[model samples]
Target: MNCDQRAIRFNCLGSSMIGIIDLPERPLPRGVLVVAGQPDSRLGAQRQFAMLARALARRGFAVMRFDRRGVGDSEGCDYNDSDVRAAVQEFCQQVPGVREVVLLAPGSGSAIATASACARIDPRVRALLLLDPRRRANAARTAHMLAPPVPAPAPIGAALFWRRSQPPRRGPSSGARLAGLAEQLCAFPGQVLVVAATSAWAGPTPAQAEVRQLRALVERAGTSNRVQIIDDAAPAPADRAAGGRLDGDALRAATCASWMVSW
Candidate 1:
């Protein structure tokens, strides 16, 4: 599998932002754009994504993975919802012969993918692959600050009741945004794949309940959506040492069914 990496500039948020492109040995029908999360630059740490990109390329798919805004070789400030969405839009438009786009995002990058899908009305985005969907830590912090603190529910029943009784919150609600994105994708007349990571941060076991809950939530939100959960064992010693590099297999699995995979 031959792979070539290059840097280019794409229009994002009305400015030229730098990005990296991973080209395959053979020409591909569709190009996959992988968007990285949080600490940005996945250039070196994204071995799994890199491997999958090469694998997909060998399978006749062109793949591209880039740093968000202020990360890596990109020129711009930090990224937000708008910035991410715009970047995806620009990449989709700039990449030649991109028949379809498969968004592969890990952790908070899922939120960025959702936002981009919601904002762009292109039918080329055939599928969205969310690996380890997580509520943005910043959003959670804001929610906590805005929400009235409950004085430790007196009992389990009370806690449940309190949770049920509260009116469903709305507005730039992260859950709502995610649901909106899912709805949009389902409405796209294409396929959607959601992969949930089953392991918790501190444990060596898969969180079956968590994966089930996430699947149910997506199913309930979009009846036509297709969701899958792959329960991986706790990261091996090598993966633990590599940090986010462990996500390659999950990403490749999610993208294999779509036109191209990106994470």
Candidate 2:
């Protein structure tokens, strides 16, 4: 079926956030608001998310994806903790006839989704779909970048160069902060689906400690939860050249998950 997509700007907490709404030619079953990763506008607006949104629309879901504050066409300088919460709150409130909300997030956006859910006293959020979340690792990277550099003796020219070349160091790791935020979100009442990339960071399997922490949090939340890890098997040459579009089976699985709840 042909999908109808519209781009619009809406005011949220005194800022204009840009978004695209996709509707199926037929009636929709429910509405989903997708949150994108850090530095990514509305599901990366990439082929993967766009294809997923279009697929959901075909399966009777009205999907909306937007640029977070300070990203893309959205108005803002930077997104802080509170702005993330406000953006989600506004997105939840603005979508019309949304019976249920599936907070879909990827990468760093997962923490934002969790925080937003935790901050809400309202019962609009029904489920969460976290695709390849990197809460701890992302936080760690951020902290490393922000951490203060140690001073060392150097020649005048060397010292000047070091001052310009050294990266800022901030206290506490982003991963640690995200863990705290995740704990808060787990307290909220909702189902969660975690999709983890097996080849995440092009490294070895996920750290046991990280996996254990995530599992414990999900269990403690008392919410319906499932974790799916993508395999790293190489595709056939023909398929590989096709740019890794999700297979039919993957598409079906995501659609089922997206529409799991009743409005």
Scored by TM-score, the top model is: 2
RMSD of each: 8.6, 6.7
TM-score of 2: 0.63
Query: Which residue pairs of candidate 2 clash?
Result: 139-174, 139-175, 140-175, 146-168, 146-169, 146-170, 147-169, 147-170, 148-169
Error of 1 at 221 (Å): 4.7
Candidate 2, superposed: residue stretches over 4 Å from native:
27-29, 43-47, 80-97, 113-119, 135-185, 199-204, 207-213, 220-259
Q: Where does model 1 exceed 4 Å of error?
A: 42-48, 81-95, 109-119, 134-190, 199-206, 220-225, 232-263
Worst 10-residue lDDT window for candidate 2 reads 226-235
lDDT tens digits, residue span 22-125, model 1: 66566565566666775646453446566666666666666667667777766677776655556556665655666667666664545544535543666666
Candidate 2, residue 220: lDDT: 64
Candidate 1 residue-pair clash tally:
2
Model 2, position 217, has a per-residue lDDT of: 54
Candidate lDDT scores, in order, read: 0.57, 0.59
TM-score of each candidate structure, all chains considered together: 0.59, 0.63
